[model samples]
Target: MAVSHGHKGINFAQTTSICLNFIQEALLKHQWQRASEFLQHYFQALEDFNSQKRQVALQNIWKLGSAILYHHPKSNVETFNAFADRMKNIGVQNYLKISLQHALYLLHKGMVEEAYRNLNQAESWRYGEMSASQEKIIKLIQAYRGLLDYYTWSKKRTELSKFDMDGFATSAATQDMHSYFRQASVNLHEIIKIPGVWDPFVKSYVEMLEFYGDQDGARQVLTDYAYDNNFPSNPNAHIYLYKFLKKEKAPEDKLISVLKILHQIVPSHKIMLEFHMLLRKSKKEEHQKLGLEVLFAVLDFSGCTENITAWKYLAKYLKQIMMEKHLNWVQEGWSSRKDWWPTFHFSYYLAKKNWKENKILALEKAFTSGILLGKGCKYFMYVSKQGHKVQKKSIKTMKKFVMKHNILDSEEL
Candidate 1:
């Protein structure tokens, strides 16, 4: 239900807060179905509020809509289209993102003509310098449009059963299709030059080039663009660079050198994890010591708030090395963002550390927070003798699946 300003008691902020709190609760409970239902009411409330305070509602709707889209990919097309219409009603300029989402969804469903129209509408709205986020969205739309045309033409080229009688027309269409990919390549390169777009653009650009059998060209383009700005801020670019170097058969030293530089610039979760893997794979005597340093550095850098993959490996390695000094920091980081990593995963680590006092509390907290029983039951068994009162049928099914997969010891879902 939506509250209007005309309602005697409630103000707009209270109504908005109530809606947001509802969404948050649904998300915390992993109730995507409930969240989807709440989103409809939230937008209705926004519409009612907008009827009175148009500007305020217009400014806030995009953020909430984007959040819903990001979190609820399974949201139906009707709902998504409604959101796009709302955005268009607010201002055509603000509809660019929802327009792109609509186009992509249509394209995925093989609605080519409708997707093309949506893309054209998005393209027509381009005018001035936009926010970094908006520019990224625009670039994505352009890249998708180009790639879609190329794929559509390729499909046409393959279905040449009737082309025997109209050879000239078929050949002309083939040439046009080739031109589509070529034009797309050029457009993607231009998009790559835009700030905040380089990382994503490079992935698609490189994929396009490699798909056309120009691996060397793709590597060079990625390298040139990534290194052009010496102080690289995007961690994915570095990760991509490392991947390119590895594929090219570069030596371990060269890979390590690049990772060293990458870690200096943007030591993100994936990057740190990759660097840790490379160190372990190299397996030199000093590599172990160096890897531990890098692992501790990652804890310091990110506060252990991200990268459970790295944390798992680090925890196992610490067990091997018999290290105990930095364990406190590890615990701190894991506990800080219990929502991101499974509470059982962290609790398992705590159990191993002989931190029995915190282990049960963490398990109870995770249990109360609604972590899936199937995902955490094994860890719970390790730290506590008493079961979590999980359904017997669910536990039996989980055990069968775990035994079949031979991952009974794994902490990940």
Candidate 2:
């Protein structure tokens, strides 16, 4: 569809599709700057259009740009810098974020000099009429600047010479360590006070504090970072506190508290084995119950269905629960979770010998999740000694579902 704008016919839909194609072609050839230029032209071509098509096109454009920029390790200074400049010229609202993201990538790659340059550029983007979010980003940019300066100083801490900082040479000599340390400390201090979780910033500050023999300061910052209410939740911040407490030889309750929150937030976290082990050893009745709950959560995850370690823990705990006459867990949460695990399925369609065959069991174990149900295995619907009434009902339901969804029955497979 074409619309007339100032005596010129512009087609928003066609232009958007063509522009995206051009951008993808550039990306396939690793031409970042070319792709960015195409995006800019796309925006300019639709500058005067105010319609649903234009709004949807703009959303797609931003999503494409974000998806491309998120892979920072694949980008370089020259190409990213060119792309960022074009985005800035196009007045992209998140140009600041793009700059900081690339700067972060540079820092991770040990390119402190380039990271510093990019951070400085990001700070420059924080010009007049800043919104609340932009202001927060500016503070983050400053904190990263401090981090970049500290990294630069640490690499040359053995020297007593001048070094480059923000494109100027400074002579802190041996004192550069403390100077950069204080610079980072002050910036991070401001950031933490803003009531948000700054994991990396707070973590780095804690390391510096520990190196400087300030234990109390490290503890305080970590506590605040973990327990703050600025964001919904941050699981790793709890992890940081947990490790720190273990190092400080703090009380068992403190470590347990941290791990409990972490488990609630991320049930499949790899470090949860430590929490499970700790709980399993506790003599408290409540702790044992919590331990069972944790095991169920761990196994419910799709990736963890075959996790042997988790299965082993569940086995030991289930044995303990049965011996203690606690059948409530079986009828409660465990049954729902067990429904998703493939290893416990009971199908009755085959002969008794075939049902007890190890080879058939192994084959079923190799498949994930659904075979024990009435759906995929109409002939062999459950692993139970219960009568044919249940089996017949399962078969009827499975047939209806199969007919509706057009899924192949067991005979076909």
Candidate 3:
């Protein structure tokens, strides 16, 4: 199953497999640069191959494309599309996936008509397929179609509100409204019946319910589908539930109860952060203490996004709490991770407060982690000046590292 490239019998399939293996290994190790390099090699190796080999290459290309989408949402669109066009040229007929992506991209850019047309094309492609995979794709297409229709109706409704509608035009609008809702209901029902875990379709349905001013309906749907099961990984569903309860102004006790349930179910950094946010809304020391606990939980859950704001706020809380307790947070060595951006700031604050050698050691740990200086280098140095003088060797090393990496200076305090 090897595709021979040149007279020397270069095996493209073996090389491609090796590249994929290396990519996976790099990703597993969180070596993103290495993973990206391997992906580029895979793409290069697949170019200009025969049709038989092209299909397999396209499959791997899509795999890499999806991984890129997940890891780096703001990646180059032209490059992605170039790969996609190459895939299409190789006789891969799964245009629905491509069209849906394009539709969403267009919609995000506010090209409503183009987005609508792309969605319609995706819907048309759904008619002739009945495979298990196709069924999932069809459900997704239905969700997007319903979303597009909702957006269109909303825009038209806004425009119609400015005019004195004649009877004929009013009737036409009424008919359109009826047709839209009827189709929406059908899509919602089908999505609900699809047997599996919750997905983007479920999120879309919940959004549609919310858009139609059915807050209760949206809450019920999320509760039944998203929360009724084990810990769901969908952040949108969690946010939707929190927003609904917040809008209702649920009691503190009730909110705490729900937070406890969500925390126990997921135990991730987001839920912990949300719990802290909720506690911050309260005007009491005990609630703030609870918020501090939530911060600790955030550090405990390593799956959190690299949220600098949360870490900075957490440092402030730690300082405040330590002052009240008449203790040194620096001595406590309160750091979640040594190699994260937040750790640098946290260590800086600890060093400034204590002015101890141990604190300097902690700061050195954060500096060497290589994750600290992205946008906080100047501020880090500012805080360092407030504390004990950093070692000359350490300063020189940091200077070299910054120069090599070209981290932009941020005038943040």
Candidate 4:
């Protein structure tokens, strides 16, 4: 009873300071659970402070708490509950921070419905408090747009479609919708027109172009972006550019350069396999030879045991090339494997082309293997059906031969 001050004597400032120190200690020790607990008590103490100055104290607490929560990697129910409770205690005067933190927390927790609700509320409630910094407002807008972009890229189309962009524009802090659009357009224009801006800027620029239905402009931008940037150093970028050029029917030389860069990057089995497929599609004999050499080199390094898909492609390519060149050794090598039933079918195709001159008997060996009975039966029927009417006798022989090796019953076939 000497001064009769009691707990109130400590003052809100002292309580806040002590709480901050405890929070710092918990963070340093990586005790997020304990840190959230401390923040709950700290916010409660602030709520109990003098009513006249409570608004200022609440605003200060929210700012500091948000900074902490935003950077922490691991957040949980307790962390969000603490933030929500502080917002409720602070009243509507601190609504923007309250709603923003709630939205962010819900987003982190994968509760998108609740996050969208809170974001809408935050946008609606935001007042002149944000008038101090246009840059901060721009950052906030970007954050919202970034979340939209995430949903778009990740194929969450239904969720992205639910968002009301018009509503967002109406409630946004900027002067008008054109300001946002202008800023975005300018950024993307720079991305396409300037060098060294490709990495950080292409994704956004492409997205914006897509949104506006500017397909031709988007293609042009991609062309310029690829031209200004070095594609050879990055195989993935090179492939993406190559695919784009292929779709546009760009010069054969441009596509060949892509293949050359890929070959230079690594002699990996997959890359060699892709090169062979591309060369065959382009119908370039010299490139096909080079691709074949690379494929053989890869086989030497890793052997034919690995890369089953590559083996399938290589076998098909070899069958086609050997047929065109009339190489008997290639056909002999192809028949040596139990798994080359498909190659036998390819050989059947070539033999059918010159059936009278070739005297092909490989189909007899293939039918005996029973490997071509299931899926191969349908292909055999298709080829037999395509025979000339004058070769109707051969067709009949083929049909009877296929029926003998058919995997399914007569009705099923």
lDDT of 1 by residue, 230-267 (tens): 53466667678788888878898778877886777766
How many pairs collide in each candidate, listed in order?
A: 0, 3, 0, 0
- Model 1's TM-score against the true structure: 0.50
Q: Best candidate per TM-score, number?
A: 2
Q: Per-prediction TM-score, please?
A: 0.50, 0.64, 0.52, 0.38
Quote the positional error of residue 32 for candidate 4 in Å: 6.6
Question: Evaluated with lDDT, which candidate comes out highest?
Answer: 2
Candidate 3: list runs displaced more than 4 Å: 1-6, 9-54, 58-115, 118-129, 161-171, 192-204, 207-213, 261-292, 298-413
Error of 1 at 288 (Å): 9.0
Whichever of 1 and 2 has more TM-score, that candidate is: 2
lDDT of 1: 0.60
lDDT of 4 by residue, 3-63 (tens): 1235567756676667767777877787766776676666655565477556765775676
Stronger candidate by TM-score (2 vs 3): 2
Q: What's the lDDT for all of these models?
A: 0.60, 0.63, 0.58, 0.53
Candidate 1: worst-modelled 10 consecutive residues by lDDT:
365-374
Look at candidate 4 and give me any clashing residue pairs.
Answer: none
- Report the C-alpha displacement of residue 164, candidate 2, in angstroms: 26
Local error of candidate 2 at residue 108 (angstroms):
6.5
